[model samples]
Each structure stands twice: as structure tokens, then as C-alpha cells.
Target: MAALRPCTLLLPVAALLFFCAAGFAVRFPDPPGAWLLSLAAVAAIAAPPLAALLRLFGPARWLAALALLSAFAFAVESLGVATGWPYGRFYYGEGLGPLLGGLVPYLLPVSYVPLVVGAVAAARHPRSRPLWTLRSAALLTLIDGVLDPGAALLGFWVWPGGGPYYGVPASNYLGWLLSGAVSSAVLVLLWPRGSPAPPALLDGTLLALAFWTGVAAFGGLALPAALGVALLAAFLARRAGIRGCARVTFLKKN
Candidate 1:
């Protein structure tokens, strides 16, 4: 890990604490101030990932990626709100803060950019663009599988009649696939030339994953929580394996 300032480290730590508090709050029946807790949880969780990504990619490339992702997310969300195409028909309920032009939330990028960056980092296969994009898209969708159900149960948004897999429609996942793939492509196209810090310790993906799983478990969503936990374990194992290989290579070179 780089020499990140104590203040920088605090962002993710604060996010983790708020998420834990929100989980406990949501676990109760008709919990007081649940909306505020949930809102704080989301905002806090997104912070460290954004900061970490910016540092990894540097400001120039990071800014470009950020602009592209933010604009795309806003446009798509506005369209979704207006026409209900991707992500199914849904409306915000409470505690998402102010809307941009009364359409999408001003901080919509904060909710999305981290997941996109993290997935890209994890799935960046050097040889095959298609495979890299596919892995990125798949990882991003898997994260939503963990996130959406918990949010739905907490009434972050309403899905009307609901659908299979804990009231989130199958179509929503389909939408995520499409969106995730497209976003991955854009990110890949804009990938920075220099080598970034290794993905494992680069950012808040693991932290985000833990928070998502914990919230799901606290909200009584077993399957999604288990899946998230499983993914986190796999990622950690992969990272450890890479480190072991790197050490072997270093010893041979020396």
C-alpha cells in the first residue's frame, strides 16, 4: 500500500462504521431514521473507492473516466426514470439527497464509479479485450445481485409488483448486464497507459463487498449475502495467489 494519509484511510473506515450502523438500524421493525442511515451508508461506502481509483489512475485519465461514467450514468438513469427501459420501472423513495434537475441524484456517479473501476481492475485480461470486458460486466452484475435485493427490502426504491429473486425482476439483471458491459467497454477504451497499483490493495472494492454482504445478511437476505461473501473470499484467494507467484519470480530473478 502507498503512504496514504490518515485522513484518506478514514474515508473507508468511516464508510464501514456507517454501514454497520445502518445494518443494525435496518434490522429493526420500523426503525427510526432508517432512511438517513441508509443514505449515509451508501455515500460513505462510495468515497474511498472513488478516491483510491483517482489515485491509481492519476487525475488525467481518472477525470476522463469519471466524466464519461458520470454522464453516461446520469443520462441512462434519466432515461430509465422517464421511459423505464433498463433497470425496470422504479422510483426513488427517500434519503438519496437532492436530484439533478429533479431527474437523477446529483451523486449518482458516487454510487456507480467505484463498482465500475473495481470490476475493471479485477478482470483486466491483457490478451483478450472481449474476455476482459465480459469479466468486468459479470463482476459488476454480481455486485448488483448483492446490492439491489437489500435496497429493495429497505425500500430504497420500489419495484411495484416485484419479481423473482427477492422482488428484483430478472429484467433488472439483464439491464445491469447491458449497462455493465457498455460501461466496461468505455473504461477499457480509456484505460491509462501506465501500470496502476495492484488491484488487491488499490481501493475499496473489498470493503464495498463486505458492506454489501453484511447489509444483506442483517436484512435477512441469505442467498445474496452468501454469494457476496463467496466472491470476496475468491478475490482474496486470487490476490494471495498472485502475490505468491510474484515472490517466486522475484527469487528466481535475484
Candidate 2:
């Protein structure tokens, strides 16, 4: 109990650090010290939800869940590399830790797993699993809109023959939709029944949303910023409505 307080306090601190690192990285072209800082920020962003998962689901289950997510993302990225069916023809840039088989980054899961978990945890659709899955997937896709443009501008990745959306190809979003749908569906179905998602998960999502939106706006990427703001508003409203409904049900039962 005593230890939890410091750990709990770390969440906001880490989140703030992430925003600073991310902002510096995106604002400057390969800023010195930004790559390592960005890597640390990724870990910081992932830590809160991960800690929550460990507490709620136990170590074994949490590890298993992470493994599943990592495998799925790696598989999809590998396929993208080989086939170029989804995400169009693009290749990674430097400073992203290490690569698996010299293909996808070893830390690819660092970028994906927590986002999926947070989106799944934040989604509210009590009666319809399909709706819940779809909502979470959409949220995932929308977030990429905010992130990919900044990354592209920062030279983190290159879309050779960039089509639209600030050098991001349309197919990239299509890939995200397909991958997001599958990942969210699997996580939602396998999530334990009657276990509420921790607030840290929501915090993680909100922090990502705000920082990305702010960065995009500052960098003059208007479309992604607008989309981020709009999606965030809708997401918050949907969650509020779901909570209201749940409260009504509880009251009626009482």
C-alpha cells in the first residue's frame, strides 16, 4: 500500500516526460538525444497501463496478454514488409531501438500493445461485443492519424510515393483498420469478465490524444489535429453515455 503511492505518482510524471520528449522529437528533425528520450518516453507511456494490468490480471495473465499482442503486431508488420498489401510501400527509418530478423523493430510492441489495451479498456459497449470491438478499432485508427503524420515529418518512416495525409498513404490507414479490428476483437473476447479496466488505461489514452493533437496543431498539421479533437470528443461522450446507462440499470435494480 505504501509503495503504491510513489508508483501511482510516477504515472503523471512519466506521461509529462513523454510529452516533452515526443514534442522535442517531432518539432526538430532528429534532434540530438531525442531518439533515446523518445524510447524512454514510450516505456513511460506504457508503464501505467502495464502496472494496472499486472495488478488486475496477475503476472501470468498480463504476460500472456502482452505476448499475444506482440505476436499479432509482429506478424502483421512482417506481412506488410513482405507483401506491401497493407500500409503501402514503406520502410522504417533509424533510431527505433532494434529490428527483428532485421525487419520490424523489436520494440514494435511498445508502440502497439498499450494502445490496444487502453482503447479496449476505454471502450464502452456492454451488450454488443461487435460494437465494442468496432469502437475500439476506430479509436486506434483515429489515433494513428495523429501519430503517423508527425512521424512522417520526423523521418521515422518513409512512404515512398506518398499519396495523402501528409506523406502517409491511404493504404496505411486501411492496414491499421484491419489490424486494429482483429487485435481489438481478440483482446476484447479474451478479457476477463467482471474485471473493470483500470483508470490508468484511460489516462494513457487521454495523454496520447492530447499530446498528439497538440503537437499536430503546433506543427501545422491541421487535418490530423482536427480529427484527433473530434474523435476524442466523440469518444468521451460515448463513454459518458455508457456510464450513465450503467448507473440507470443499477438504480433500477435497486
Candidate 3:
């Protein structure tokens, strides 16, 4: 384990998510089990960035990304509490048996890891054509629209007070938009070299969510929307004079 420590540094998040998903499946039925296990997943996904950010402690970009992600998380959560819109239709039941603030449990937002990772992966995938770019953005915007409450039915995650808002309310799709835009934007700003492999953390989370929350809950709605956003992003980048913004996969050597 000690020898593997250094190797683990690059993808600490994926490792965490792998275990977490397993843990969630273990207890399988209890909400408390799901909540704690979900927190572990959050840690898993967050570990990589958190490690990098810690190394760059004083760098403006590091702090900025953290603040930006945190802000998006805060906004998505706060809005869910206030408007009962976004995420999905499920609601929290009295805040983790009173140990929590009776507000949303903090661990829940950790699930954003895989979603954010998905955005990052989409940005670099060879098949990430512009058509899906902009479309993805729109669909992601509405992903939480149905996902939040939909997941709740499977006992995946939930919001408080349990609304039936606009016939489709939860804190899900809102996070997708944030994850799609903000994560991509941050990666662009960071301009990392080489294409990144999709993180295992993302895969684990998706699998877990599928088991407990059921991935088909939202249909293909979010997928096309995300594609659309990405396409729009590609076009807008070209307009702003960013070279190859229209290109999803460059022909040049990596």
C-alpha cells in the first residue's frame, strides 16, 4: 500500500469512488448507509483536485477553481432549498436523523465528482464533436430537472420538503449545467497537456447511481442538451478567435 501511494496520487479520486460505490451497495437499503457511503464517494472524486490544489496552495488558479466549484455547489444546493427546482423530485427526510442541520446533508454534493469528471472527459474525448458540445450544455441544464427526484425514488439522494415543483423539481440538472460549463471552463483555463483518460471515479459513481438511482430515470434528454452546449461552445470559441475551437479532435499528434 505504501509503495502504491505515489502512484495513487494522480487519480486518488477514482480510487475513492470505486470503494464508495461498493460500500453503497453493501448496506443497499438504509438511507444512513447511503448517505455516509455517498460522502465517501465525494471524497473519492474530490481527492485528486484537492491534492493538486493543495500543492499549488498559493496559485490563483487553484483557489479560483475551488471557489468556483464551491460556489456552483452552493448555488445549486441553496436554490434547491428555496425554489424546489432542479436535481430531481425526491426530498430529504429530516436531515440524517437530526445529526445534520435539517438542511441538505453536506455529503450529497460530493456526488458531483463523477458528473464534473464527465464534463472533463467530454472536453477531451476524440468523439467529442461540436454537435454534442452545445447540445450537451442544454441537456445538462435540464438533467437535474428530472434526475434529482427521480434518483430519490431509488433511494439514491434527496432534497428536503420533497417538492413536485413545475412537475419536475430537484437540484440535479442545475448541477449538470454548472458542471458542464464550469468544469469545462476551468479545464480550458488550465489548459492541461494530453488527453485525459476518463476517471474511474466517474465510472464508479455512474454505476452506483445506476444501481441505486437508476440512470435511465431521465432518458436521453440530458445527453443531447449537453451535446448542443458543447457545439455552441465550439462555435463561440471560434468567434472569439480561439483556434480549433470548432474542432473536437485535432488531427495533429498528441
TM-score of each candidate structure, all chains considered together: 0.80, 0.82, 0.49
> Residue by residue across 21-40, what tens digits does model 1's lDDT show?
54764666245665465456
The local distance difference test score of each candidate is: 0.70, 0.71, 0.43
The residue ranges of model 1 lying beyond 4 angstroms of the native Cα positions read 1-19, 28-43, 194-197, 200-202, 241-254
- In model 2, what are the clashing residue pairs, if there are any? none
Which sections of candidate 2 miss by over 4 Å? Answer: 1-20, 231-254
lDDT of 2 by residue, 1-254 (tens): 22233223544464455456556656665666655755775676676667766776787788888888899999999888777867788777765656688778777888678788878877746678899999899879888998888777777677888877888888999999999999998878777777766555554565566667666766789998898788666645544443322211111232
Candidate 1 backbone overlaps, count: 0
Candidate order, lDDT descending: 2, 1, 3
Worst 10 residues of 2 by lDDT: 244-253
Error at 24, model 3, angstroms? 6.6
Steric collisions counted per model: 0, 0, 36
Candidate 2 overall lDDT versus native: 0.71
Q: Write model 3 residue lDDT over 1-254, tens digit each, in one string.
A: 22332222423343344434434443354555555544554564455434433333336665676666656665655565556555444445532332234445555435553454444443343444443444445534543443443354444445444544423443455546645665455544453344343233133223333332222222323443344334334422322342222211111233
